[model samples]
Target: MNGIILASILLRIAGVGYSLVLLKRSGDRRFGFFTVLLTFMAARQVLTVAGTTGTGLEELPGLVVSGLAILTIHYLDRYVDEEHRIKRELKDTNEELTIFKKAVEHAGHGIFVTDPDGTITYANPAIESVTGYEPDEVVGENPRLWKSGEHDQSFYEEMWATICDGDVWDGEIINENASGEFRWVDTTIAPVTDGGEIEHFVAVDTDVTDRKERQLRIEDQNERLGRLNRMNELLRDVNRRVVTTTKRETLEETVSERFVSDPWVVSTAVVDRTASGRLRTRYVTGDETAIDAILEDTEEAISTLTAAVDHGRTMVSEQVKALSNDDITGDTVGVVPLSYRDRNYGALVVVTESSKLFEIIDHELRTELGDTIGSAINAAERRRELVDDRVTELTFAIEDADAPPFELAAATESDVHLTRTTTDGDGQRIVFLKVDDVDAETAMTAAASISNFSDPTLVSAADGACLLRFVASDTLADTLACHGATLEALHVESDTGDGEIIIDTPVGNDVLPVVEALSSRFDSCELVGRQEREPTIDTAEGFRGELQADLTDRQLEALRTAHLAGYFEWPREHSGEDVAAMMGVCQSTYMQHLRAAERKLTTNLFGDERTSDRRPAVA
Candidate 1:
C-alpha cells in the first residue's frame, strides 16, 4: 500500500512540473505562476506523505489553499459565461431600439417628442410635412410657433391640463404652417413618466383638412337634397287636393295652408288680383301677425302682386321690409300669379324668415302651383255654368230605409247643421260628418250649403244612420253638381264626433273645395278616396250596371230576392231566413251572399270600406 501511494504522489508531482513548463511556453504568466505553485505543493505533499518533506499539520494550510484555488477557477469560468450572455442581450436590445427609431422616422403621421417643458426635442419628417418646418428648425422650439390662432388660449390650457395629468389627450386641432395657411390635424399626445413624474411628451398627428372639407361638402349636399324632397312633397299634396275641387276660395285656402306648413315659410297669404285691379286678401295662415303687416304694406304686397300678375310669372322679393307695420320684421318673399287662359285669378304670396339661402326652393315649383290654382278656379267657374244650365232648384231628401252615418243623423237632427254631400261619376256619395248626436232633425241641404255641390237622395235611414247618393249636380232624385279634387287629409276627433266627408266632386273640378268647406265646418276633415274619373251622362241604368258588374250571379240573385222581400226597408220588413227561404237557400248562405253583394256595391258607390254598415244591398 505504501509503495503504491508513493508512486501515485510521484506521478502527480511530475504532471504538475510538465503543466508549468507548458504554461510558461504559451506566454501565460498567471497560469505559469499557478502551475509552479502547484508543482511545489505536489512535491511537498509527496515528501510529507512519505514523512521525508514536512509534518502533517504544516501541510494542512497548503491543502486548504489548493481547494480554494480550484473553487475560484470554477467561479471565474461561470463569470465569463455570464459576461457573454450580457453582451448578447445588450446587442439584441440595441438592435430593437434602432428598429423603433426607424419606424418613428418613416411613419406617415407627424411624430414629435418634447421635454417636460414642452420644448421640441425630436421631430420626424412627417412633422415637416405638417408644419413645413424641417426637423432641424423645429427641434428646441415650442409647438406654439405653428399655432393657427384659430383656437383661443383656453383650448391650449385644456390640452396641457389633459397631457400633464398623465391622461392621453386626443382630438382634432387647427394649426398654421410656414406659409400662414390653416391646417387641420387629428392629434394624440401622451406623457412619458420617470419615477412617477412626467419627464416628456410624445405627440402624434394626422393631417385631416381635406377629409374635413369633403365631409362638410357632403353635409351641404344632403341638406339641399332634403329641402328639394320636402318641397316635392308639399307640391304633391297641392296637386292631390286639386283633384276634386275647383273652387277659387278653396284653392287659395289650400295653397296658403300648405305653404305655411313648410319649415322654410314663416307665413303665407293668398292675395287676389281682382277684376278691378285691386289686391284683396284671400286666405292667410301661420304667423298671421307677421303676414298681415306685410299684406297691408301696399308697396311690399300690392306692388309685388301687381308685378307677378302683370308679368304672369312668379316674383321673388329678397329682404323685403314692411314699412307700414313698424312691429313687423322683414324677410324673403315669393309672389306667384294664378292665371289661366289669359284670365288671372290672383297671386299667392309666401314669406320666409329662414336665414339660409332660398336658392334651393325652385321657382318652377311655385309656377306649377300657380298654374294648378288657376286651372282649379277656371274649372269651378266652368262647372258652375254647366250645373246652372242643367238643373233647376230642387232638394232630394234621404229616405228612412237608407241609413245615414251617426254624424249624419246628428246633422239631420239639427236644422242649422245640414249634411252636404256630392257624388262620383258612378253616382256614389260618401259623407263623413262630425255632428251633434241629435235624433233625426237635420235637413238634406247639400244644395243650400254649397252653391255648386250636388244634392244627395237619401236611400235609407235607420238607427241614426242613412245612406244617400249624390252624383254630379244631378241629384240622386234630381240635384245639381260640378268639378272636384282630393285633399291632403287631416283628421281631428274630440267631444264632437269626427265628420269625415268622402265627397265626389264633379269631373274636372279640383277636390280642394270640398276639403276646405268640410274642414271649415267640422274643424277636422279627411278625404276617403279620390279617382280621376270624368263625369258620364247621368242615368240610373249606369249606376245599376256598376253595382251589377261587381256581383256574382248568386250575389245578384240574393240581392234581388232580399229587395223584393222588403229586406231593405227600415226594421227589415222580413227576416233574413224568410228572405233566404224565398230564395231557396240556407239563411246563413243568403246573408253571406247578401253581405258580399252589399259590400261590393257600397264600396263602389260610396267608396266606403266598412263591411259592418250594410247599405241594404239592393239594386
Candidate 2:
C-alpha cells in the first residue's frame, strides 16, 4: 500500500507540473481547470501516504481528484494539439505576406493602395519617380492632389462610379506633378474586396507622357502633308484652266468659280481697278454677302485692294465681317494680286471658311497663283488684238549710244538703216541692215565691236552702201514684239548716233506698258510720236506696180521677152540671142538687163539681203 501511494503521489506531482506549463502556454480555461485537479490529487496522495486516512476519507478525496484529473488530461491534450495546428497556419500566412510586401516595394510601376474614399493609404518607392512625390508625401492624402484639371469633374465621377461598383478602371490620365508640369499616365485601378465589402483600391500607373507627345507630333506632321497635297492638286487644276481659257472675262469668271468650287472656300470675287480709280467687279461667285460687305466700306475696301494691286502682293485678313456666317465664324479673307511680269491688272478676293486653307495657301502658292492668272489674262488680251485691222503707230526716238545699231553707226561714222528682221528656228533674230558711208569690211568691224551683235557677216557692198547680216538679241524689235507691236522702220544717224523707231500695233492696245518696258531697257528712249491709221489697199496689184517701178524699161523688156519666147525653159526653144533679137538688143546687153532684174526681184522676194562671194577690205 505504501509503494502504491508513493508512486501515485509522484505521478500526480508530474501531472501538476505539466498542467501548469500547458495553462501558461495556451492560456485556456480548460488547462487551468486541469492544473487545479492535478494539484488536488497530488495533495490527496500525500495525505493518504502520511497515514492520515480513516473511514475512507483520504481514499475518497484521492479517488475523486484522480478521476477529474484523468478526464481533464484528455481534454487538455486535444486543446494543445489544436493550438499547435493554428500556430503552423499563422507561420505560413506571415511568410506569404512578406513576399507580397517585397514585390510591391520593388515594382517598377507606381503601386498604391487607397481607401474607399480615394485617400492614399500606402505607396511604393516608385511613386517618387513617377509622380515627382515621395511615398510619405502621398500617403494619407487624396489622389486629387496631383490632378492637372485638364479633365472635367465628370471624368473623375465616372472613374469613381466604375471602381465603386467593384469593377476595374483603366485609362490614361493627365496629372500634374510636384513640379507643376503636366504628365500623362496610363493607370489601372481595381477594388480590393473583403467578404463582399470594399476594403481598399489598388492602382498601378505607368508614365507615358513622352510616348503621348510623340504620337501627337506625328499626327501634326501627317496633317500638314495632307494639306500640302491638297493645295498642289488645286494649283494644278488652276494652271490647266489658265492655259485653256482664251478671253480675259471668261478666265476671270472661270477662276472665280474654280476657287469657290473648293470645299473650304465660301466665296470668290475678281475685281479690276479701272484707270479712273474705280473698282469694277469683273467676276463674282458663291456668297455675295462677303463681297457686298467688302464694298460697303468703300474707302477701306479700296485701300486694301489698291495695296495689293500697287504692291503686287498677297493680303490676308481674318477680320472680315461679311465673310463670317452662322455656322462658321472667323473666316479668312485673301486678296491675291493678278499681275504678270510686274504689270498689275486686278485683285482676286477669296473667302475661306477653313483655317486649313490658310496653311495651304502659303507664300509660294499665293505668288504662283497670281502669276498664272496674270499671264493668262495678258495672253487672252493679246489674242484679241492680233486679229484687228486698225493700227496704232508709235515712233520712239532712241538716243542711247549703247544700242547696238547706234553704237555701230557711231563707231563707223555711217548711217544705219534696218532693212528687215527675221527669226531663225532657234528663235534668234537675223537682222539685215544697210550701212551707208562705210564699206563691207568697215561695217563688219563696227558690228563686231558691239556686244549685242553676233556672227556679223558682210552680204554685199556697192555705191557707198554695205548690206550686213548678223544675229541680234534683245533689240528694239524684240522688245516691241514682246508687247504685240511690229517693228515698221528703224534709222540711225551718222553724226550724233541718234535713232528713230516706228512700231505698229492694233489700235486699242495700251501703249503705256510698252513705253515703260522700252524705257526700262534703254534709259534715253522717248516716245516722240503716236498715231492711228487705216491699212491701205496694198494687195497683189500694188506689189506688182512697185516691182515694175524698181526695174528700168530695158530690164523690164528683156524679162518679158525672155518669158514669152521660152528662154527661161529648161530645154530652151529660144536662146538668149533669140530673146535679145525679139527685144531689139544685143545678147550681152539683154543678159545684163536680165541678170540685174533677177537680182532685184530675188532681193525683194527674200529678206533685203544680197550675198556675193567677194569680200572687200576696209577702205
Candidate 3:
C-alpha cells in the first residue's frame, strides 16, 4: 500500500475511465487500445504489492514508464478520433460546396451578384446569353450598363429601394444588348442580408423578348379590328339612311352626320359636283374647329375633292394641320369619290384626328359606300322627276358617233329609229330599233359590224321596216339613265352617221353631266333644243280603248280584279286563287285570263313586234 503502488493504481483507474468515456462517445475500436496498456500497468502494480516481484520501487520505473505509456496511448487515441471527425466534416463540406457550385454554374436563368454599391461582382454563365455580354465584361461594371433607356430613373430607384430594404423586387425590363438591339427580360432582385443589413444583391433574369413581342403584336391587331368594326358600323348606318331618304340634300346631310358621329371622324363635308362641273360643299357637320381646319387648307381640300369627283378615286393626306388654338392636332383628311355606273355625283370629305381612320377606310369600303350613296341620290332624282308635273326636255345632235344606231344607219343607208332601250342582267344595253328600207337580215348584219354592239338579231319585219335587237356598250341611253333622265327619242338619218338624242328629266335636274358624257363619246355634240313642258298622260278612256283592242273581255276583267285586289303588290295581298274566287271564276280559268292580260299589257307598254320564230334577246 505504498505511494508508488497507489499512484499506479490510480493512474490505471483514470485511464480506464477516460477510455470508457471515449468509447461511449465514438464507439471506435482504437479507444480500446488505451485500456490494454492500463491493464498491463495494473498487473505490474499487483505483483509488486504482493512481493511476488521485487519491491514497488524496483517496479516503480517500469510503472512510471508504463503509466506514461498509458497516458500517451489514451491521449493519442483521443487525438486520432478527433482527426477522423475533422476529416469527415471536411469531406461533407467539400461535397456540398461542389453541388452548390454546379447548380449556380449551370442554371438556366441568369444569376448575378452585385456589391452593396450596385457594382456587379460576379455573373453566372447564363448572364452572357441573356444580356449579350461576357461575364468578364460585366464583372467590373454596374448593372446600369445594359439599361435600355425605356425605363426612367424612377424605375431603378424604386427597385433599389425595395431590394435594399431586404424585400425582393420583380418586374419586366427592356435591356440593350451588345449589338445595340433591345431585349426583354423578366427579372427578380433580392438583397443578400447579414444581421438584418444588406450585404449584396442577387438578381435572376429570364429572357422574354419573343413572348413580349407577341403580346404587343396581338394588342395592336385587336386595336385595328376595333377600328375596322367602328367604320363598318358607320357605313351600314349610311346605307340604311340612303334607303329611307328620298331627297338628295337629306341623304347628304344624314351621311355627313353619320360620319361625324364616329369617334375617329372629327368632321365631315359632302362636296357636290354641280351640272357645270363645279364643286360645292353641300353639307357640313361635326366639330367646328376641325371644319375650320379643313377650310384653312383650301387648295389641298379642293385638289382632293376634284380628284375624287373627276378620277373616281380616294385621296388621303396627313398633312392637313388643325386650326391654330384648337385642341385637335395632326389631323387627317380624306376625300372619297361618290360615283356609280359611269356617273360621278361628288366627293365626301372626312377629317379625323386619328390616322387609324384612314387605315380602316380601305379601297373596298370606299368604293362600296361611294356607289351606294350615288345610287341613292340618283334614285331620289328619279323620284322627284316622276312626282313633278313640269319636265325639261333636251335635244342633242351627235355627229361622228360610234353607237350602233349611227353605224347601222351609215352602213345600210337607212333611217334607224330606236323603239325601246333597257339594261340586261350583265349591264349591257339592249336596244330595239326599227330600220326603214332594209330587211331584218340586212339591219342585223349592219348592227353587228359596230365594235360596241353585240348579239344582233331580228325582232320582226313589216312593210319594208325591220325591228332589230342588239346589245351596245357606252350608248346614249345609258348615259342619260345614269344622270336620272329618260331617253324620249333617238334617230339616225340615212347615208350619215349623225344622230339626234332627246331626253326628258325633272325640271331642276342637272343636265350637264349627261351632255358631257355624250360629248366625250362623239366627235361633235351640240345641244340643239331645250324646252320645258308639263308632263302628259293618256286619258283613262283612251287607255281603256287601247287595252280593249288587245285584251279579251275575260282577260280585262281578270286583270282589273287582280290589280284592285293588290295581287301585284310585294308579298302579294291576295293569292291567285283568292282573286279568282272574288271574280266568281274557277282558279285555272281566272289564271289563264290573268296571264293573257299580262302578256298583252307588256306588249302594249314595251312594243312587241317579234316574229313567230324569234326568241327574246339574252343580252
Best by TM-score: 3
- The residue ranges of model 3 lying beyond 4 angstroms of the native Cα positions read 2-12, 20-97, 152-154, 164-166, 222-234, 273-280, 298-301, 323-326, 390-619
Ranking by TM-score: 3, 2, 1
Better of 1 and 3 by lDDT: 3
What is candidate 3's lDDT per residue for 5-72, written digit by digit as tens?
A: 77777777777778767767777766676666677667766766777544458657765776776677
State the weakest 10-residue window (summed lDDT) of model 3: 610-619
The C-alpha RMSD in Å for every predicted model, in order, reads 23.8, 10.7, 14.7
- Point to the candidate with the largest lDDT: 3
lDDT on C-alpha atoms for all candidate structures: 0.63, 0.78, 0.79
Q: Per-residue alpha-carbon lDDT of model 1 for 1-619, expressed as tens digits?
A: 2444444455445545555554545444554655666677677666667654333455445555665554444454456457657878999988998998899989999999999999999999999888889989999999998998899999999999999999999999998998998999899999999888999999998989999889879998898788778777877888888767666668778778877887778778877644234556778887777667655765765567677755677888764666234554437778888877655666777777653424765677667778888888787777674764321111112222122333333335432222334445576654433233233224355322433234545554454544344343323211112222322112222234343322334443333333334433443334444454343343678778877877899999998988898999998999999999888889999999999998787676654423323221211
lDDT of 1 at 590: 91
Query: How well is each residue in 302-370 modelled by candidate 2, as lDDT tens digits?
Result: 566666765777888776555555643327778899888856677898877756787778867887898
What TM-score would each prediction reach against the true structure? 0.48, 0.53, 0.57
Clashes of 3: 0
Clashes of each: 44, 0, 0
Worst 10 residues of 1 by lDDT: 392-401
After superposition, candidate 2 runs with Cα above 4 Å error: 1-92, 113-117, 164-167, 191-202, 247-264, 274-276, 284-288, 294-305, 319-330, 384-619
